[model samples]
Target: MQQQRLPLALFLSLFGFACAGTARADAGSARLPDWRVSGFGTIGVAHAGEREADYTSSVMKANGTGATRSWSTDVDSRLGVQLDTTLARRWSAVLQVVSEQGLDNSYRPRIVWANVKYQATPELALRAGRIALPVFLIADYRKVGYAYPWLRPPVEGYNVMPVTSSDGVDATWRWSAGPVRNASQVFYGHSAVPLVDSLHLYARHGVGASNTSDWGALSVRVNVLRADITSNIGQDLFDAFDAFGPAGQALTARYAMDHKRMTLVNVGASYDPGTWFVMAEANRAISHSFLGATRSGYVSAGWRWNTLTPYVTWARVQAVGATLDPGLPTAALPPALAPMATALNAGLNSLLMRIPQQTSFAAGLRWDLRTNMALKVQVDRVTPHDGSTGTFINPTPRFVSERTSHVASVALDFVY
Candidate 1:
């Protein structure tokens, strides 16, 4: 993998040349050198109109923009950088990276957050290498698209659980309850990603808990997680249903994907109050292999008008358990293995149609143009149910699964 990212890019270029030689030896010192550096970016383009699938905003992307062409910048370009250091009295540290377009489509740069913290007092704090997986509610700035006003983040509620970061350890606490203010957290981690074809997705042990609260302009959040995942991305259709003996080993033990057991739950809320704003969230997921259950949500609203804002959103995802099953029957099979048991029950119900039902509606506009820039435009209008093909991607074969797609986007965000 590019020589393991060259030692995290030479340790972030030797910590940015030792924070630029401690700010040129504290140039006329007035105190301000404990280290800091920041960045964020996006320059995007998108278009889709269902050209037979391919409009992705993560499924760990492998292709995007209707039929993979017409228009796309891989759905959203990206760039990031960060650093924060203090490393002493109560310690502190962080490191970011980013550089988008992955799942082997390359734009490399990884390592999102390097972590190290400890401020064990005034309301606790603690961390360890690589963290961030709050599971939702802008999950730690959701890739900083100029700090949100949409052009993303509603892939049916952030694509269910696209997991972002995890290595191990976390702790947080913060207080105040009178006029509300809180920040609970707890974690333990493990993760591995890489999807699409060569597949990989592991999430071991991973534990979680989250909470957030505020009162002034209202805010709320809640989260829970569990893990013990594993993947083989359809090992040859569960080894052709384990060669059909005990009902093909009982359909590869009721839907393969090995070490299963996944669970997630989330809740969110927002309500700005400066001009206007609103947000909502919901989630649910359970697994018994083939990623069985699901339920997603989204809601957004905006209106600011000074530097433009205008927004709207409503999303959905639904597939609450079992999207088809019933394999290995082939009528008393024996007629020469009955066409290989009806082609392994039609390739395991066509891989359970990838379990995603959909609905989307969006509208956007954001202009902020300064103070770290922003500019956006959006449109969505998905729609896929029953014959699901929602999170589109590489369909073709005249792919028309309950057609209804329309995507449009434009972006230019920045931060520093």
Candidate 2:
């Protein structure tokens, strides 16, 4: 629909200001640029019980069971490297790259972040370039398996929005008062992601804000974001729809994804005292087009005993209607075209079912093998909503009934 592009002038202005300000602020400091390199990875194996469909982590992946007919390492395996350099006392830069299974089934390296940061003061900072989209509580570290207690974030909520990185600028403010720390961030950016079957998503204009509060072992966070979305319905399909003339045009106007706005809201709370922890997050994603709306959340609890921690989690996602009318206006059309209209309506209904609606239960254990490495084993039982396939992709024809999938995974996560 609507394509929004970031202007090169905006990036140039931000970059120039940071470099000039840093040079002036650090004129007296003799410290040279400091560089640090670190890496993180996960080696994992996964199997899904469903034989008719592939249970995937996100829309970007084509891994899992079904036609693969074998355990998939691509489901939970990735390697990432990060480099951070201090250009001056008040300015720094970070670049992070990750290699993982991608939409094309290749282990291509993707630039997740490459941003220059300027510390305006002790409590205020500004950054511009490619930055991670903080759409959820753990958005910054979602790829770093070692950062979270679970082997992976619950797909029910995390998989709703697949765009990972945004090209734009953001400002963060941090302060502390009476043992309580608070941080607020505001960002504006644009991103694009490719999905299954030649589906491409373009997010042009986006703006969001998040607030986090930390009080000892207790923490809370809330975030809200809105973005304009544009996606292609495939060239062949478009041609066919166009052939139907005015009726097809009307259908496209109602269903084609172009220039629709999507909104996301998330809230989370966690309590951790080293020995035991409980965390919960809730999210709602809505789009004005056929992407429809979904509500999802997860609750997890874990207790640590020395180097070993066991956790249990429950998660669920549900569809909240596609905002489509149940009755089609086929009666107003010519009798000869009525049948075609009915068929088109049926296809539209089938497309709307793509929205995920499922529930999952998981139990896992994390063993800290070393200071920066951990071993994890997790199992999940997922039940798709009646007659719905949930997040699984490439469903076998006629296998449209409700079904359950059991997944087992083991991973070694390391960070340095």
TM-scores of all predicted structures: 0.34, 0.90
lDDT of each model, Cα atoms only?
A: 0.82, 0.82
lDDT, candidate 1, equals 0.82
Candidate 2 residue pairs in clash (backbone atoms < 3 Å): 1-258, 1-259, 2-259
Return the lDDT, model 2, position 368: 98
| Model 2 poorest ten-residue lDDT run | 1-10
Worst 10-residue lDDT window for candidate 1 reads 2-11
Per-residue lDDT tens digits for candidate 1, residues 39-112, read 89898999888887788888787898888798999778889999888844565668888888977788878887
Q: Model 2, residue 2: what's the lDDT?
A: 21
List the pairs of residues colliding in candidate 1: none
